[model samples]
Target: MAMAADKPFTLLDRCPPSFEKTAQGVCKLHTRYDQYDSIQGVGVGGLTSSLPARRDGFTPEQIDLGRYLFFDPLLSVDSTHSCASCHQPDKGLSDGLARSVGVSGEEIPRSAPTLWNTAFLTSFFWDARAKTLEEQMLGPLYDAKEMGNNPVQLLASLNANQQYRSMFKQAYPAASDDITLDQIYTALTAFQTSLISLNSRYDQYAHGYHQALNQREIEGLNIFRSFVARCAECHQPPLFTNQQIAVIGTPEPEGMPLDIGAEKTYNAPKLKGGFKVPTLRNIEKTAPYMHSGRFDNLRDTVEFYTKGRGHAVPEGVEMNLHWHIWEPNLQDHELDLLVDFLKTLTDESFMPPVPKDVPSGLTPITHTVQTTTMINHSNSAPGKGE
Candidate 1:
């Protein structure tokens, strides 16, 4: 069972430069979207929506303690895969694999979702199965094909380590002598909430810097929000997701049966093949797209939307595809423009320092993704498409 099944755990990850310590040792996060406060933020294009509730009653020590747990593979049953193993920083907090390989080297059903801005989310997982972030941790931490560790084994390992014992005590200065499962959930929740990303070129344009995006990109943004394409209906901006489940009829890899997404969660037939609309904040880096990682790149992913409604759905499946899925019939360059606009969302400003060593002395599975410099196209006039 997941630790603290009786309680709840909050989430965010890695204290970035935006994090600051108060005189009382509480951590405060400063974000760009602070200006957009109301439920319906009044902003450029009138496309921005209000963010959801976030948790942050955590100390810096707790955030730091969670950081160690995040990168250390000891959280796994056999001391192999760490949380970072699937969600790496370099790749926009995603593994960049079509589907993640579990601790047993077995291929899982879906790709790893990025952890950026997770603090603002009310739902967890592609199917929206878990209500809280702590509940979500149970999926990967103990799934036989995932981290493969149980609560008893997990507590035993952490309690056996003196450094961990000290760290937990420090993180929870008022807690008991030995480490408890609640503390583990708290620390992890603290760190996960710390992972924030809001400073992007699109953010600049959204803030009234018309020059932040070139002419083509601005048009692409228009198309994205346009009723015909209607990309923004679900992937609404500011956060780049409405955080609702949509049955988009995305197909699985060849020869694979349907994964029947949120239907199992709510037990509604109409919800079949539905998944949470993921954040497009750093969509450029987290490729092969979709929950099953069906598409390889942004161009392909965008192309899927234009290929007519339910075009990719396997035959004989009368799925309740989201109404947003339609035949937009966008052109080649339009597809490319959408990709350019998406690339403008890249922001790695909140990356936390990867711990060099953990208390367990286990080699951390630090998934390192190569960083590439994005072209500066801010305020550029309409020109030939790159």
Candidate 2:
């Protein structure tokens, strides 16, 4: 049954009523990073440094309102795609696509990134163009190939609905009667900040459960952090990303022209094909990896890194790759082991339930499970445990 509009949205993790708030309106979060006092070291395996501060602590009303907005197609120029259209609850909060296609069905030039641990990220988007989540939203909200909406039209759409007006008013009691763009951004950010994912088998091991991972997975973890592979150097533990720009020399899909990744954003020559390093927290759930979605699976993607550094770089293109990019000459078995360890990072513990029906009266959602073969962690078959 569809939930009543008046009822507050349900949540599985931290919230205002359960935790005390400071005078600044900030509520302290209980994260896995908080489990360890201060023993975590930067870039070290089996130990993680304190996570960057999160943007949590929104009221239940605001969060519930954001939840409704996130799934409502009313935000798009055409009443077809919602925020949930791209960032689905399934598929690890990422659409299962090589390149995202908007309501117009036009190619969006890059893959939809996973929103798993975005609350902890300082930078947003592949090019590291936006500093805040609100800024990040503007790109998709108005981009012709993305949501394709303008602020004027968006507010008009929200105001047209009586339920939305009431919801927004309740969410922001002291604000004006008129709905504003800032409120929309804040609501979205609030809901997204509540998307916490830190209870995986890997997290269990990180929290000091020796039997959580079998010997094979443990070996894989060792190889992952070892200098030989050095995957952990950029894909740091806890969040699994150093969150910096790097010209990794990833290739564009065949027949597609060069993207010039972060070069346009920074206007620098060295960053000709750089992009923000994404967290590998739910690597198995997101397929067709890289900024351009060049490789199809983990094996092909991992093998590309050791394939003579800039081997995948288009012919005649001179590039300055990140210093970490080097030939590791990893064995096939070792590569498989590394993949095994990555699967242990899967955790949908705090995944919010998709609404049955949104206030906009449009169909709530449609998503496809990724076709890529991967470990089914729920089955609890040995190393790939619950």
Candidate 3:
């Protein structure tokens, strides 16, 4: 999602309590926009304070409006696939599927990544195609394989709904008479940007709660920081991603289609294999890792890195996959530590509660089992306490 602008706004009562305070000297996981003033690194400048007034850089009305849009099926072509369809709350805000099914019921190519803490993302999309969350919002709606709806048609769909009409008024009083596409994008983006993830086991441990993570997990966290893995270079501490692109050269499955990695970087030709480095937070729950969802389990992911992405073999430099940082033999126990540490990144309370009025007065579109229910409305799932 897009980062909150440097501007300020009043707070909502329903903001996540855990993220309400800005603890100084707490080892910032991510920095502000000016923090990266040196050479164009990730930087943010909005509300980093713990005060509720600016914690999310969004007003209550905007968040409420965005929440409705997030769950609204009207954003889709068939009204069968809302944003929440693939990014389910129970599955760490991710669908936990290697390939997500689209409105047309065709399997999409990449995994549905978690929306939690996406506000800090420097780039959007698996390939880092879209620069801002606002641009990313345009992606699924138009992708033939995803929501499959034209932006104009989707706006008309929302405008036709009476409930949505009321929401637009509450969300944008100044622009109440005319709810344009820009307003829809802004509201939806605000809602998503509000979905921050913190208060995980690691957060407690970082705050000096010694018993937060077990011994094995602690050791694993150390391994993750070690140079052998050099994981922190990309998947850094705190937010767990440096917001930079890396070419891991993940092998494509036998029948999968090929992808070009930043070949569009220049008019020149480029290899079609690279993908963005996703955050490792809530890693244990958001499984089937990687851009193409090639690795099913955490074990395989650790093994991939331990083996230096297959590039660190002796003498045969080209044979080994990750030639940059390859250690010959990392113990199996060490790998276990890395995986255990990663589990501590899970934030159980990341999912927000569905507004009681989201579906009120609106005709609930009956759907099949293939269509996942609104996660915000489901009580059975964990981390749903509003």
Candidate 4:
């Protein structure tokens, strides 16, 4: 499942009627899709209208199967944690922790990134380590610190279970009696691609409902787009990300080794400390921020950028000069406005309800009862590091 060295990464090129290509070859989905317009008023378009097309002839049945698998702890070796454990739907598909707690009770090296709008991404993970969603899905399942499922054992477990067997067969009728790892990956990827987030106040404002934003929010939006802050440069419209990694010189967490981010994947020295730019579609819900989760609040994150923290590059790493372009002289009110603008990105409509029970019979990790119990237990501290 590794990405071929010669493979050229590309976004969706198929132009729908709602989108038109500019002279520069960039296709922009108009801010007036009928679907979004119905939700709000006129002028409510999606940020990116790039919906994922079915892969390998996948259908809704397979997506349902993937949804079950995503919540089932049976996918883990210990039957303690599931994909939903860290990527909780209520928490914007990211566990509300500085770093993720794995099945081994050890802290995963990086924060669990939000799965929102992943269907539009060319690369996966904080380091862009995975070239595709299938590759990204396999990384955690096989990681010793994460799900830690042995592939043979995992398949065997599924094969032995009559329920899973029936579900797999239904999901992949062509592969009846032979459920391969590739099918599992495809199903997981399909489920993730279904998690799209494009209904927010900002979306409404961008679309046509100009009154969707109040005076403060409108002022904040102006600040965000203005040259002074220029937040829109990397956090571009629609997807709110350029889908590229940059060395922003984020400091190494205390007592932790320096994470060279995308450099680890490409083996390129110049990419040290660079991480993928994440979408801001659900910024208010997905916190703490950045690759290391250094800032717990939006204000702190904005202040960090205003101070130009990346100006002093680390000893061995090259800095991405784009981080230095932010206007440092922003007043407190303007910063508040900026934070307010980001808050408008939150869209609770994207949150899916946790299934009451999973076929595995293991308590659903996303269940409120289980989550509350886990929070109360000292061993399951949210931010406890490995």
The candidate that achieves the highest lDDT relative to the unseen native structure = 1
Models ranked on TM-score: 2, 1, 4, 3
Candidate 4, after superposition: displacement of residue 140 in Å? 0.7
Q: Candidate 3, which segments miss by more than 4 Å at Cα? A: 1-56, 265-272, 308-325, 355-386
The TM-score, computed over Cα atoms with residue i paired to residue i, of candidate 4 is 0.80
* Candidate 4 residue lDDT tens string, 1-386: 11112322121233322334556443344433333322211122234333332222236555567777898888888777788888888888888887776766666567888887676788888888777888777778877767888899788767666666667777677785877888888878766766756778888877678898999999988887776776766676666776777777766556566676777779887777788878888899989988767789999888767775564456665654445355467888999999999999887674555756666666678621122213222232222111
Model 1 bad stretches (over 4 Å): 1-16, 20-24, 38-49, 368-386
TM-scores, one per candidate: 0.88, 0.89, 0.77, 0.80
lDDT of 1 by residue, 1-386 (tens): 12212222232333447776777767777665666656642332354455566777678778888898998877989887889988888888888887676665655677889999888888888888887778788788888767889999999988887677777877777889788888888888888998888879888888788889999899889888787788888887778888899999998876456878889889999999999999998888899899878999888899989888898888888899888788889999999989989998988876887876677777667773222423222322111000
Off by over 4 Å in 4: 1-57, 309-320, 323-327, 367-386
lDDT for residue 32 in candidate 3, whole number 0-100: 30
| Backbone clashes (count) for model 1 | 10
Q: What digit string (tens of lDDT, one per residue) describes model 3 on residues 1-386?
A: 11212323222434343333234211112323223223221222111212111224555567667777776666778766677777776677777776666665555666777787777776777767677777887777777657788977877776765566666776677775657898888878778877767668886776568799899987877667666666665666566776655656665444564444444432224323445678887888887887657788998877876554444222322221323335536788877777788888888674777533343233222221275433221122111000
User: Candidate 4 at 202: error in angstroms?
Assistant: 0.9
Could you tell which candidate, 3 or 4, scores higher by TM-score?
A: 4
Q: Model 1: how far is 257 from its true place, Å?
A: 1.0
Candidate 2: tens digits of C-alpha lDDT, residues 282-379: 88888879975788798888887777788877888888999889999999899888888888999987787777877666677545222333322233
In Å, residue 117's CA in model 4 sits off its true spot by 1.0
Q: Please report the TM-score between candidate 1 and the true structure.
A: 0.88
